[model samples]
Target: MRISLSTLGCPDWDLDTICTTAADNGFDGVDFRGYREEIDVTQHPQFTDRLVETMARLADAGLTVSGLSTSIRICFADKREENLAEARRYIPLAHELGVDTIRVFGVGDAEEHSLEELARVGGETVRDILALDGAADLRWLVETHDNWTSSADCRLLLDELPDDNTGILWDVGHTTRLGGESPAETLDAIGDRIEYVHVKDAVYAPDDENAKDDGWVFVLPGEGELPIDDALRELDDRGYDGWVVHEHEKRWQPYVADPEVAYPAFAEWYRTVLE
Candidate 1:
């Protein structure tokens, strides 16, 4: 399996530095977060041009643009239309960048939708996204997060959609947290539809308040308490060849330290554990 690092770890770093860091660390690709505040997606009249430039820069650095990671909420009660309209913008951009998949979020209660309503809304939103996807030559991926963080729930919703242009971003830590499902079972639920994986550790102190369901506090690949070995074994057993991006999401935490210092150590630890 190819391993990559999420650009989110270095949100304060420029794109060039992000790519250079990933390349220098012997990572195969860089999972670019184009929707971060640092990037001005609306500056260019032509989003495709921006995409080309972005991909070209990565190519120059000898790195592949693993995927376009975006923080998109698919289900909103009052703003659903506006959200979808803006989201359709990423499809063509992904296509132009020669990147096949774009990351998106599942429906959540933050949108004022009830749990049941969120599922219904989630299904409908996926249908709409897939409809728009037919012309983009790109795939739409919903991460294991928010309301659909449960693997069973996500699997059910994904079953409702056409797999031709839709799949799952199997975020192990997120799903494990929200689903209350075992990692093996979660992997079995998603099965072949997992387009990518976000590798992070969920750890907690015994006395910490957030110590529930595998604990809390997202950490680097190995520092936390996640059963990452078992998860990777399951992925291997399933023949999953997609990118497994190290998602050091809480890199800003003083305990976690800078990604530059944490990531290489994390990667080395990951390699050692996997081996």
Candidate 2:
């Protein structure tokens, strides 16, 4: 399997720094969750007007564009047109960047709507996006996040779409920590639909008031309670050779180690444990 780091880890780094640092750290690719201060890469000049140069820079660094993670949430009831527009805007950008997958979210409050409602709406939204021109060459990945962290819940969304162009971005951290699923159980449910993976580790820290409502505190891989090793082994057993993206999430959670520290740590740990 190949390894990549998401720009979410290095939200302060420019394109040049991102490429060079990724190359120096032994990462095979860079997934663009954000660039510098801009979370939406589609609107960033380096990716819009200066795309060719950006591509050349990555190639020179012996790195590829793994994928683009967008803020588009398909399951939201109030943002149907906005969600579709975001997908339309990013799908072509993904194709232009020669990246195969665009990450989206199935985010909604379960109290507001049932899982069935979210899955149905999210599935139809992704299907509409896939039907757009030039979307055939791209894959839309719904991340295992928010209300869809459980593989069983994700399977509900996948069952509605039933298209090869749509798949899951298996976020091992969420599935194991939040959804209370074992690696084998998650793979058994949604293995066939997993086209990409996001890896992070964290521990339930009830003492830290800043911890998430569920008391989860982000930690470097192998230091936390997440069963990432088991998940990676399962992927290997299934003959899955897709991108395993280290999502440091420094952009959203600034308390975590900087990408400078976290990126190499992940590269080394990943190699030590999985390579």
Candidates' lDDT values, in order?
A: 0.71, 0.88
Residues 1-275 of candidate 1: C-alpha lDDT, one tens digit per residue: 88888766776666677777877777888876643454424334324446566677788888876887765676555557765776676666666666787787776674564556665666677667666754346777888886778877787668655678778998888766656777788877776788898887767665665454544765656677777777888888778888888877643443555778867876786578768
CA shift of 89, model 2, Å: 1.6
lDDT of 2 by residue, 236-267 (tens): 88999999999998988889988888998899
Flag clash pairs in model 1: none
Best by TM-score: 2
Q: Candidate 1: worst 10 consecutive residues by lDDT?
A: 38-47
Please list the Cα RMSD from the true structure of every candidate, rounded to 1 decimal place.
3.3, 1.3
Candidate 2: minimum summed lDDT over ten consecutive residues — where? 123-132
Candidate 2 positional error at 130, Å: 1.9
Model 1 segments more than 4 A misplaced: 34-53, 110-116, 133-136, 206-215, 250-255
Give the Å shift of residue 100 in candidate 2: 1.2
lDDT of 2: 0.88
Candidate 2 residue pairs that clash: none
